[model samples]
Target: MVFLIQKSQNKDSKAIHLKLSEIIASHQGTSNRMVNIEDLTELELDQLRKFYVQLSKLAAKEDA
Candidate 1:
């Protein structure tokens, strides 16, 4: 039962990832680098998270 549930969840996750990849590819300003973001290492994801946080701060400052 547990294995079946896990498999279903994995399938759903893959579908979601594919949909997001398609959206990223079709969007003009979106970064193609983000298409396979799930494959990034933990450290790389952390670095990207930090970069986005800083970007958010900068945007906030601009709005103020």
Candidate 2:
């Protein structure tokens, strides 16, 4: 757990996966989790598009 946290301090993003069978067998959740970037719904995709647009504008403001 400490090693994972230390590793992530330098990266933009990290994805973690935990197997369902392992969790079921152990009766405990894995310390790793991830968002499936490929599985975004249409609405979520649109929201992300809008967010990048807004983020770009904010970045431009710093230059202006």
Error of 2 at 10 (Å): 32
TM-score of every candidate: 0.56, 0.43
- Model 1 pairs whose backbones collide: none
List model 2 lDDT by residue over 1-64, tens digit each: 9887675542322111112322332435542322353354445545654655576687689889
lDDT, candidates in the order shown: 0.61, 0.43
Error of 1 at 28 (Å): 5.9
The top-ranked prediction according to lDDT is 1
Best by TM-score: 1
Model 2: worst 10 consecutive residues (lDDT sum): 12-21
The backbone clash count of each candidate, in order, is 0, 0
Error of 2 at 37 (Å): 1.4
What is the overall TM-score of model 2 with all chains considered together? 0.43
